[model samples]
Structure formats: C-alpha cells, structure tokens
Target chain A: MSRLNEAEIRRIAELAVKQLEGQATAANVEKVVHEAVQRMSGEGAATAARHERMKNVPPHNQAKGQRIILTAFGANSIGILAGLTSELAALKCDIVDLSQKIMQDFFTIMILVDAGNSDVAYEQIRERMARVGESFNLKVIVQHEDIFKTMHRV
Target chain B: MRIELPEILETIRMTEVEHFDIRTVTMGINLKDCISDSLPRLKNNIYEKLMRTAAEHVATAEKVEAQYGISIANKRISVTPVALVGDGYYAEDFVEIAEVLDKAADNLGVDYLGGFSALVQKGFSKGDLSLIRAIPEALTSTRHVCASVNVATTKAGINMDAVYLMGKIIKQTAEKSADNDGIGCAKLVVFANAPEDNPFIAGAFHGVSEPDVVVNVGISGPGVILRAVKEARNADFPTLADHIRRMAFKITRAGEFVGRKVAELQNIPYGIVDISLAPTPMPGDSIADILKAMGLQDVGAPGTTAALALLNDAVKRGGLMASSHVGGMSGAFIPVSEDQGMISAARAGHITLEKMEAMTSVCSVGIDMVAVPGDTSAESIAGLIADECAIGVSNSKTTAVRVIPVPGKTVGEEADYGGLLGIAPIMPLSKIDNSHFIHRGGRIPAPVKGINN
Candidate 1:
C-alpha cells in the first residue's frame, strides 16, 4: 500500500468533516476524520515510511541542528523575554520560535531554539537559563524537542 | 505535526519544578555462560563478560540523557542471579564472586550492581544456601553490590527456613556494617514473587528466561503526580484518576523512548519499562506527598491506604496503555526512609510498621526501607517477612522487605544512610516472640490462589 501524503490526509479529513456535517456530532466528526486518515494511510505504511526517513538522517546532522523547548513560569515581570533571549544569544543559540503570556499574575514563556551551533553543552545552556530565570523569580526548564514530539505525537 | 505549546510547557514544568525524571536505566547482563566449577575461573569469566557487556552502559545512558535533556538518575547493572551461576560454589566462593561483581561495577562506573541473589521460594539448592550465607559478608565487603533473596511465591509457597535465615543474615549484615549505621542491610531485600525484569535495586536480577543482555528502564515521578493531583484538587474522583492516568501515560512513554534508545545504542534488546512512582529522599519527590495531595491530611492518615490503592491502580492503568511491555513492580512504592513524607509520618507516630504492611497490600512492594530498633529479634524480623509473604502469596502480588535493624539505635532515634537510601527513625517492633513459628523450618503450603494452575 502506498503511504498517504500530508495533503492527502488533509483532504480526507476535510471531506470527512463535510460529509458528516449535519448528521454527525462533534465526536462522530472526529471518528470519521480519524477513520478516513487511517484508511488513507494504509495501516502501517506511513509508520514504516517515517522509520525509513528517520534512518536516513545521520546522527551528526541530527546533532548539528538540535531543537530545544524552553519554558519559564513564575512572577510576571517586564523585560523577561529580553533577558532570556539575550542569554540564548550569548550562548550562540538561535531562537527559532517563541510565545509568552501572563495569566492570573503568573508569567509563562515558551521558546523553541536551535542550539546546534552553541559553544556550550546543552546542560550548561539549561543551567544558565535556570540561573537567569531565578534572578527574575521564574522556574526555567530546557528540554529537547524530541521529548515533546514523542510524548504528544503518535 | 507541530506539538502543542501547552503540552510542551507542561512537560518542561514537570521536570523543572516537579521531579519528573527517568529514575534508572539498568543494563541486565546475563552471566550464565560465565559459570565454572573453579571459583577463580568463574570470577574471571564473570568479570570479563560484565566488562565487555556493560562497559558502555553508563556512558551510553549519559549520552542519551544529554541528547534528550532527560535526567537518567541511575545507571546500574543486574546480572543473572549469582546463585544459579555459581552452582556448586560455597559461601566463601560466593563472596569472592561478589568481590568480582563489585570490581566490575566500579570499573564500569555504575552506582550499583544487583543480583547477588538467591531464589529459594520452594527449597534451597546448594548454591542458594551458600549465597544466602555469604550475603552478610558480601554486602558488607562490597561497595556497590546489592543482594536479594526470594523466599516466597504464589505457586511455590513461602520457604520459612529461608525466611528465618534471611532474618539472621539481616542482623549480621547490620552488625558487620555497624560503623556505617547498618548500611549493608539497606542494600538487601527479601522478596515474595519478585519480578525478574525489575530495574530497581536492591531487588533487580536477570531471570533465567531473560535474554543474554537487556536494558530495563525504571521511570519515577512522584512529584509530578503530586502536582497534578494538587491542580485537580476540587475535581471529582473520576477527574482526579484521569489526571493521574494521563500523567502516568506520559511518564511511561518517556521511559519507553529512553529505554529503546539506550538499548539500540548499546546493541541489546530493550527489556521492560518499570512504571513505578519510585520516591527519592528529595522533599517534593515523595509518594506519600501524592497521597496527601489526594486529600489525606498526612500519609498515614486513616484514608491513606485507600488513597494509595487508587493512585497505584490509576498509575498502572495509565502506564499499561502507554507502553507495550510494562513489567516490574509497576505501582507506587511506599519505602519509609526513601520518602520524606513517610519518614516524617513515622517520626510523628502517625505511621507504624503495621500500617505500612496494610498499605503494601495495595501498593507495589511491602515493608520496604523500614528501620527497626537494634534489639529487634531476628525471629520477629522473620515473622514480618512471613506476614508480608502471606499477603503476596494469597493475592498473587510481589511483596518485599528491606527492613534494617540499626545497631545500637532505639525507637525515636534516627539512623542515617546517606544518598538515596536516606534516613529513618527506628520504629518499635512487636514484643511478642515468633521464634517458634519461624523455627518451624518448613514451607507454608501454597494458598488457593496458587492452585489455579
């Protein structure tokens, strides 16, 4: 069986939603979309393809451009992002993406960084970030992107 | 697909604020082929094989930890039960073998090497007897070698003779390491129906059925569960259980990922992920704290056992869904000394040894890391093991005892065994003597549960 591409999956999902519009409840729409995706993906073929792709990516290349997800939560303070991003810059880590917000007087920030070219080790980067966060009374944590992907994604 | 930012942040929060981390990635190296009738050759063979198999164990685990930013708390090795491998060896010969294990573990730079163990659930073989006798000296002499003896199983019944012998061994081990606060006893455990693939010490051992070498992972995160329960404080029972189940699912998935990665890197088969909420001496990382979060005033409060039963069941239900292969004592551990909340509860007289036994009936392992008075009789200790074994055998669960009789320490006094073993307030034991019962050197017949086959 051929593997389903991203576009094919999206098309199937959209079609399933449209076909179930009036007759199906929200959960039924979800079930229809899920079944459509499952049918289109040809059972285990998509997973096999993913494994094949993962094998071709060399470890050196994988390590050269590592992804890190950093989160800081605690007291809401001004210039917190400036302080954090500047520390990443000093460590030679590039911020690929970022989001920050304050809820109920608690500040929360999430930053995705490419630390491939960083001069320091990942542990050192985490330590520095934690130290900077502590100065602002925040709890900082740095974790690799794979953890989130493996945990949240199938 | 891009992962949700909230999920990513929650994972980060768990590890950063809560103590979510991979507790152990133990390499199980089978030493069956290293057996020899000559003691010296046996030791040499075992050492060479362990060095070759586990040389990269610690380094590989550390490398994976660095790559994933997950803390692998301990790197350890569990070899084939030494009693089986040292078939005809005597007590002294077993001690020599233990020294070799200690040397290999030191060379590999791992913290602990388990499986200086004997499985005598039914009856003692020559090797089992020799190993049991050698346990006290072996544990006292070796720096990182841990020992366990299985004295009961559902099918085989409880070996009262082995239980009584282990009681004496425990006393001797405590006295042998008296200067170190009976720390040797901390490295030993007696089990009923012990899991072969358990990655946690002091009870990890490679079973005969296991492959030549395997990598088993033990993932722990009591603090993370505590935080989740705290957040769901006002929720109903179903919501609370669902929250714990989801958290356990995530934790086990993380463990499975790490275990597979480490196994692949080391060129060994991935064993099982022990999804136990193993507590540490750290304050927030206490399983008892999770119980308190479930609305219990303190850990040993009246509703604590029921609360623990719910937590344990939820953890297993969630973890079983996440991992394809889940084994070991995969539930909540209520070790007294290892958990700060349990320690304080014992000191405050809110928890006692009897209550601990009751709690264990619903949890993973029983009567673990409990410290008793110096004068606690060996017979009484054996009686404690018998009771715990009865619980395990009747219910077809795994129960273990790692009680330490701290030499020269009385009730209300504390004995400190630093590092992960932690400290414990010596609890008083029953005054009633059980020497007659323990001295009745025979097996207790298997219960009705064991007759299923």
Candidate 2:
C-alpha cells in the first residue's frame, strides 16, 4: 500500500541503466522502470518481508558492494570459461572483471562478479558456483571481496 | 577499489599453503550472576546461561569460515573464574560445577572451556581453597574443562603457599590421569600475572573487570612468519624486524576482521585480537622454526633467548599497529609439546629444561607443555614454578607453568597426546633436592617498585 521511496526509485533507475548498457533513451528507461515496478508490486508482500528480514543483517556482513570474487584453479582445458560464464549468465550475475593465467599444465582464473541485480541469495550464488567448479573439475573459491579489502587494504 | 591479482593470490597462499588460521575465537562469559545459595540451582543456572549464550557460536564460526575461506582452528569458551561464582560451595560442589561446564562445552561443540580458576596471588579466600582442592578431581572427571590458578603478580609478589599447593595438585592430576600420559596436568596451568582476556585454553579466563560477555580472538601464523623469515635471510636485524612486523600486521588484520565479523553476527562486543603467534604440532608451523630461520643453529643454542626476545618484541610491535583493540598475552608462544620444532629440539637434547626456563623470561609465557620424569618430586615442581614466577615478578610480565610428570615416562621417552596437544619428549630434570627451600611456604614479599636493576 506504500509507494516506492526515492532511494528505491533511484536503485531501480540505476539497475535499469546497468541493464541497458549505455543505450538508454527516455522511453526505454520509462519502460524498464515501469516493468520493474509492476514486477515488484506483484510480489509486494514477499518483497516487504525480505526487506524486513534484511534489516537485521548488519550492512558490512552483506555482500560488499553487492559483489563476490571467484577464483578457480584447475588443469588447462577447453570449455572452462564457457561453462562458468553460461552458469553465471543463467543466474543473472554480471562478470565485472576477469583474468586467467596458465602456468604449464595448470590454470588459475580470477573473476569478479557483480550479483547486485540477481534475485538469488549470496549463499546460493556461492553454492551454484561451487557446482560449476565441480562440473569442470576445478577448485573454485567464492568469497566476498570484503575480506580481501579488510586484510590487504587497511 | 580494485585489489591486484598478486595480493589476492598471496592471501590465498597464506591460508592454503602456510597454515595461517585463526587460532581460536573464544567467547568469554561472566558467571557471577549465575550464583545461588542452592548448589543445584547454581549448576542449572550456569548450564542454562552457557547454552543460551553460546548456542550460535559454532554455527556462526562455520558460516564466517566458509564465507572468508580462512579456517578457524578452534572455537572455545572462557568463563568468569568459577571460584568467584561458587564462593559458598565446597570442593565436591566445585567438582560438580566442573561437570556442568564440561557438558556445556561438549553440547555447544566448543573444544575447551576454561576459567575453572582461582586468583590467590596475594591470598586465598575460603572458596579459592575449595576450588584449588577440587582442581585435580575436576580435571580428572572432565574432558573439556581447563583450570588455571594465578599464584603471583608483580605487585603481590609470589604466594609460595599457593605455589606449593599447585605443585601438589599438578602431581595429583598427573597421577590420577596416569594412563593418558598424565594429560590432566597438561590441562592445568599455574600462572603469575595471568591475562584476563587470553583466548588460549588451559590459561584463558574472563577477568573480574571484563564485560558480561565478549568475543576475543587469538591469531596463529608461525608458518607464515617462518616463510617471511626465510625470505629475509640476508637482512640485518632491523630489516628482519620490519619483515616480521609487516607479516604480523597482515595476520593481525585478518584476525581482527574475522573477530569483528563474528562478534557482529553474534551481536556481542568484540573484546580483542591477541596477536600471539601460537604454534601447532604441524610441520613448518613453529616458533622454534622461526627462531632457527632467524639465524640460530637450533632452538637451545646460546642466543636462543635473544632470538626469542627479538621475535616476541617484533610481533607485539607489529600487532599493536594492526588492531585497535589488543590484549591478552600477545607474545610468541613456545609450548614445547604443541610446537613440532620444540619437540624435535627436546628429543635431540638440544633444548634443556634450564634453557627453556631462561627463554620464558623474554617470551609471553613460562615453561609450557613440558613433560618431566614420573619421579619428579612435588617440591621440585614447586621450585620450578616459583622460579618462573620470580621471572614474571621481576620483569612485570605474565608467566605460567604447564608441566606434566608423565608416570613411567622418562628422558628418551615421549608422551604422545596426538592432535593439537601434540607429542612431548620427556626432558631431563635436575635431581638436586629443593625441599628445604620450597617447604618454607610463607609468601615471598612483593618485589621493590621498579629502579632496582
């Protein structure tokens, strides 16, 4: 019964811009925002309940910057990147940055993924990524990037 | 905003390769309010409080460990010294209280519960007398309960009466648990100037001044520092100190991060990050190895104390810079049975009991996890503890004795405690009698205030 607040509207607008990938027209922005509002309102009670649940979680414990860092270690092989990317795409996780190195027969790939817009939980994302790692016979480490920042930064 | 690839990889390498882990996340609970006139009510109150407060400790630690990819070696609990809570209880009642604590620790899934303790540095109350009497039986009856008694302080001098009593108690504990290599003695620590917020077991206790409940962390990374020391082999002392400081800073930061996160999740105040480089029995993770890497021929060489002083000082200096809240005995721990290198040194007869005693002067704690001969007399044990207490009193620092007299085990034999408690080589002890000196059991007056070099 309550209308969206300014911050919520701003969050929606920002998510829409990220989805549009710089091809934002006024009409397109309006249409995306309209769709999102309708979808959210359709799940009004559930969304409000989730928000209430989230209020108890301290901000720092949440995904820092709404992102996670995934590091994979395994033997050099084909379809590793394709398989991982497809799974991430299916989960609506955006690959913000990625780098890979192959030393002799072994390979180490580090990917920074943004899961802000994904509907899934952080634990679910980590579990799903673990499954993908298992499928590729890789040892995948999915950690909230906040830990690295806490240790390596200050 | 971006962390480089090398930095990320280095963090991973520290945990995955170097055996870097949070030594323990110890929750300290105050039991003063759980006291009651009825023994049964007191026992029930203590059990219910511990169960309710620490209900989520293990689960929270697991979640944090999984999230951060860093391992928490042990989850533990420390309570307000039971002697303070059970003031009117008898020794038998105290033993029953120890049983409740043991059961609570087991049900909570914590490895150990400390603070079955008494502070009689100056003198003992009636309750302290009861708790002291109960120690051996309490330890023998329980698996997870640990006990400590503070018998000296810089200001209070040494309570030789308490010192002599603890020696007898240690002997009784060893004899009662004789089948398990006198393991009960391993769980009892006698201290001079014990730290209130220490997170390590067999010594940790929630001090009188502490808040009702708080979470404190102990950091471990001997392997990480050993690697750094190896890499800086050619550097001079100052440069070497810097390398150690930087490494200590990183590990302490990691510890503080984990501690704060755990406390946040538990909704309790985060007490401290004890930056002690506690070593384990695992290969390459040892304070002795770090000393050897620091140019010592072996741990017991002539310069062993100097090497330990340097390592201990550098750890404290670096750790102080890394965390805002630091407390406990934040110095390099050299538990003989717990550190593999120390065990090797003992087995080789390279590190003698005398050398280890001298080293405790400059280290965080006194001679720890030492297993002497079965026939070692109680007076000799009292003499040894008094010696360490003298060092602590003179230097205004903390010291302790966790010596075990393995029944039927002597020099050239080893007490195999397995897993974390590790193996202890029965080191030789001097046979010269100190009965006359120890039997004069009055208090040693407090040392002169500062200025008497």
Cα-based TM-score, every candidate: 0.83, 0.90
Worst 10 residues of 2 chain B by lDDT: B444-453
Error of 1 at A52 (Å): 20
- Tens digits of per-residue lDDT for model 2 on B361-395? 88888789999999999998999999999999999
Which TM-score value belongs to model 1? Answer: 0.83
Tell me how far the alpha carbon of residue B42 in candidate 2 is from the true structure, in angstroms, after superposition: 0.2
Candidate 2 TM-score, C-alpha based: 0.90
**What lDDT tens digits, residue by residue, belong to model 2 across residues A13-109?**
7879888898899988889888878876777768789989986775433544777788999887898999888989998887888999999979898
Model 1: lDDT equals 0.90
In the predicted model 1, the residue pairs found to clash are none
Worst 10 residues of 1 chain B by lDDT: B8-17
Give Cα-based local distance difference scores for all models. Answer: 0.90, 0.92
